[model samples]
Target: MTGKEEPKEVRKYLQQSHDRIFENNKKWAEEMQKKNPAFFKDLSAGQSPEYLWIGCSDSRIPAEAITGLDPGEMFIHRNIANLVCNVDLNVMAVVNYAVRHLKVKHIVVCGHYGCGGVKAAMTPKDMGLLNPWLRNIRDVYRLHQAELDKITDEAKKYDRLVELNVYEQCRNIIKTAAVQQCWAENEYPVVHGWVFGFADGLLKDLKFDHEGQLKEIQKIYDLTKDA
Candidate 1:
């Protein structure tokens, strides 16, 4: 096969699959409109979402699908492992818009059980460019090394790391200047840590209080007075 050449079945299914996807989308749109005539109209006018979701990019775990929220009800940002990297401008921009512009009341940092990202980070192998990204998770493990090292079972450690990753990302979001500023002024965007269970189709809340934790850790990371 040349640079452009491909198998016949591959080409056939590519078109057929896309055609089916569009067909499904059309039917979905019609069903939505039939249920609510103003569904698209309201969605197109402008988005005023009350929540901003930071979640993993796993296709099996969609933020909207699990939350049972309609489109435009929530502003969403998805990435590998749902990391809230302070250095990543992509998440910062989403937080900025969601907080300053949309005034979203809640921000959910959701990770899933059996996350491949968490599993990869748990191993000792170096994964090239992923090293820099995975380093964030490594840092989380290091911070909680005392607790994690105590867990004997590797599977339990992996799952525990998944929850801890979400907790760390939630803390990262709280550490941001934007979130700090908004939290000071109105406390509109409350950050949360949650884990999705693929086995049972449920989202588990880690139950870490944003304001309370902020108060406890504010001794070190608080920037409200500096601002």
Candidate 2:
């Protein structure tokens, strides 16, 4: 298809999808208002989401839809590969608000097995627009280069890298000042690492528990200060 015709074709499909979503939203809201008027009424006044989901911007894996969660249940932040870069002001602000104010109990760093962003970071190409954003994953690869190089199966190696990226991002969240402060004050908020498999539409836990991991991070920070 020609470039000019592509826009018309895309718009045709998008318009259909948009209209359906609009109808669904209206119906869902009306149903909720009827079934549980008090819940929706309080939600209208303010939101107090209990969980924060950091996920990839991949359209196929929406946090709410995948988890069957209602609005005001989970605060979310999505980027190219659900990265957790310490320097990203946008992600930092979301973390700050979710942990400090919303008082979210669980923070999930979710990556997917066949993540395009992770695949890009595995390559050596200069991604002009996404270079800075993907650098965090690249660093993860660098840190685990020795183990990654030892894996013989190419596909298995890539999968390992994807899991490692999720683990590292989960660790990164624990290092953040807001999360640390939350830990210091209350033990309610726990960070978790997850990987969504596109084939089965299932989320697999990477077994990164926040409580034990935070202690290790604190030790590292303390040792650095001592040095």
Candidate 3:
């Protein structure tokens, strides 16, 4: 009954939870080996994924599982709300490497309808250090305020915001020099915006027009002209 000690049930649960991860890892490795004897050897060599996925760091949605992509098939970068900020070196670095080195054919920005990050941005409160990160979502709301304001239901409005956030992030990716220059020369790395619905466990394609959007963006943010 020490105040600092955890209960026996809690300790037992913690131990089992920690042990299960290794147990599952061993089982998964064995299964992979049984399917493909060279799976580990191939995985250890290098990765050449065809797709770059920027998605929300939500535990409920596993990108590869939903898309039926195996390991090394997709390069994934996850954050609170799947934002692609110009000043964020981390996401920018990933985009640069994915395009320049990996030469991924598709770049996807996927958000979800019931995202906690988007919901927090919708709320009028200070979230300490998260304010800057969530402000990107708020900016998305501001840009589409007219359309969002007209919606009568809050739930529908939230869903719309999530979709719009994904759209804006996709636009951000297209604005990058890595994507623009690569597309100009190679015509690959098509950008897409998708929203995942937890209710149905399905992804909804926003059908982002990569070529059309690029044409419009290059009118102002053109980086390939000099390249």
Could you say which candidate leads in TM-score? 3
- The residue-by-residue lDDT of candidate 2 on 62-117, one tens digit each, is 89999999888999999999988878899999998999899999999999988999
Q: Give the true-structure RMSD of model 3.
A: 2.3
Q: Write the per-residue lDDT of candidate 1 for residues 27-137, one digit (tens) a residue.
A: 999999999999899888998899999998999987888889989889999988899997899999999899988999999999999988888898899899899988999
Q: Pick the winner on TM-score between candidates 2 and 3.
A: 3
Cα lDDT of model 3 by residue, 111-207, tens digit: 9999999999999999999999999999999999999999999999999999999989999999999999999889999999999998998899999
TM-score for candidate 3, please give it.
Answer: 0.95
Clashes of 1: 0
The alpha-carbon lDDT assigned to residue 42 of candidate 2 equals: 85
Off by over 4 Å in 1: 1-6
Off by over 4 Å in 3: 1-9
Error of 1 at 145 (Å): 0.8
